[model samples]
Target: MKNKIFFLSCFILLSLTSFSQSISSSPYSLYGVGSLYDSDFGAIPSMGSSGIALTPSNFINNLNPASLGFMPLNHFMLDVGGKAIATTYQSSSKSEKRNNFQFSHFAFAFPVTKKSGFSVSLRPYSSASYKISDLKLPILDSNESYYLTAGGTGGLNNFDFSYGYRFTDKFTLGISTALLFGNVDDNRTFTILNSITNIHKKTDYNGFRATIGSQYKIDSTFTIGTTIKLPTQIKSSKVQTVETVADEVLSVIESNTPSDVDDYYMPLEIGVGISKKFKKALTVNFDYQKSLWNDTRQSDLYGDFVNQDRFALGFAYLDEKSNFRKYWDRIQYFAGANFDTGYLEIDGKRVNNASVSVGINLPIENSLSSLNISYSYGQKGRISEGLIKENYHKLSLNLSLDGIWFVKRKIE
Candidate 1:
């Protein structure tokens, strides 16, 4: 237990200090806080990211904070994960490919009392990383063609703390507070072909959020859960610069000069889910989620923001007894599918996404901990109406440590 505690502390420090690169390249990320992070902290992501209604007997359930109350007494859980993404973008004229590796999330959960628990987590809520450049016709009356370039980097990070209380044997309630903060750097540049004129612009962002969740057990095998994330506004500031370089001399019009900008609004979200566990081996779950972007009455400069909805279904298989004779029996298998009606609307068309996922949880030798690995393939957007299409493959890996802590030991 002491060793596990030390390891958890080390991992938390590492996550805070490590400079992991961005894992996304979708142009759609330009709409919101970048592409929203879909995966949670543990094996739940492997099971189609649907575990709101399921209890956390073996892993962390950051989806529904209310499930935290279901943790066993004296049991502490820690999860650390990362992901890799490979994406191909296609248009009517050309295609390009991009790949990235990034840290996913880290979390810790433990029981506070016999009927209560709490958890703390650090994860990226969204990411924006894209670069697009093209040649444009001469601006205004200028005969020289200029290069048009637009790109953005940076995203929001969520530091969340939650507490869950069991109201009854069958019901639990929880609340979460999240501190959201980040810098969004949007860069748009125009450069003349034969002149030393370059213009650039950028924008930065900061925010806060909260959520409530509940879970009800219908029976030994069935459970239902719900969650709501409150909306908030992100304060933003902008800056514009113009630079000229000629004959080994450089001149700048503005450098890091702050400009006035309107606040960005994040949409409210609601989700409901159900889960059924059969005979302690097979578990199935389904979820429906919606983001109320329309209510925020906000729109991006590049696209219109509309309501977003998602549906997912998944299942997992676990062996209660590791049948030492058959290693396969000790491995857990998971698979699921999801469909999303995206929030970004362009040219009277809505961007959507569809994906399928599969994963396995393998028990570590001589321990209750497990190593989880999951893979997903998905497509986003359409190549019609001058819009680009994206196909992506993602791989995730996590280590979940479940162990007893703060208990008296019998020393020989």
Candidate 2:
């Protein structure tokens, strides 16, 4: 019980992110999912990571109800992972670089009945962290200069409850709804004093995300599965309050006033994915998904970084001798590619990026996770020159602590 509780504590702490500043680009958020989450939760192993996602149909696709139909376990599963980022950037006048370790994700899934299951996942759904410091005294009468730095975090973080049910021997259905919460903190320091201001804006957005899929076994040599997800709706409150150091020291500003900002919605996607296997161990999955970004643009709480198309190819392998897996295939190892097209808005213009990425699986002991590391790289083009673009790269690791509690049947 202690271990289970300890594991859950990690989830609560993880939701409270942002001790530093980072800028990650996402086809959705202009930069990645803000620092709130891994832009491609294993979607891209390297730079060119794009699209619906190449989730291995069995244990990892719990978020998608159709994917839950693939679970062979009557038990439970828990997953955890994180990543360290080393990023550098350049334009014309100056170049900058920074490094930091960010908490990536944590998840838990379990069964509810003989043919039904449920899951709870805590993850950052979106984020905002920015830091800029410069003194205006440059050549300033060459006399004096004072520098100030400030960092803030905001956006959607996800807490969800899901259920999956197998209606027939070959059919399964799933639905998951999520609640989003936003937290922001502003820390500032200058030549005179240091202070921290808290901006807490709460939003209650209920979204319905579900999938319907089925599987068919054609003898032992062939098996196939397919799934589809409906569009989602996210609604939330748009009230913001900013308290300054003077407000804290002098009690000057209105600390509890709510802003009259309007509520907004996040874009939804229509997805279809399929999987095929031969002899169990050797399997392949291909997913095609189109996000209906335009559907929510005017009502979208998010910016123009929304992507309309995302594609992914994923595969896995195992060292035949591994026994952790229930299927004939022992150690599940996989590799795949991706391509995405999306618009990025900066100075009132939409800059489109065409990016690609690929990756492989490395399982530690043939479970839902291992000491697995995936890498990817991709380039965005169109405006500047031939490769006038964004080069993307990522490296991430996954870990899990899993076991079963067996109640031995006593001989009567």
What lDDT does candidate 2 reach at residue 305? 48
**Model 1 Cα lDDT, one tens digit per residue, 50-101:** 8879886778888888998888999998888877778999987889998877
**Top-TM-score candidate index:** 1
lDDT of 2 by residue, 1-412 (tens): 3345344534533532342234343222323223324433432343233222232322345335444544545546666555555544443344456554555556666666667767777666766665544322222365554454545555556776767677766556667766666544444444323553445443333444445544444444344444454555554443445555643573224444555643444556556555555555655556666766566554222235455576666655444445644433333445667655553443344444433434444333334443345665545443321112345555555444444434465885
Which clashing pairs does model 1 show? none
Worst-scoring 10-residue span by lDDT in model 1: 8-17
> What's the lDDT for residue 240 in model 1?
78
Model 1 regions more than 4 Å off? 1-19, 135-147, 190-199, 242-254, 319-327
- Candidate 2 Cα outliers beyond 4 Å, as residue runs: 1-36, 39-58, 132-151, 184-257, 278-281, 299-307, 319-332, 343-369, 379-392, 406-412
**How do the predictions measure up, each by TM-score?**
0.87, 0.66
Worst 10 residues of 2 by lDDT: 46-55
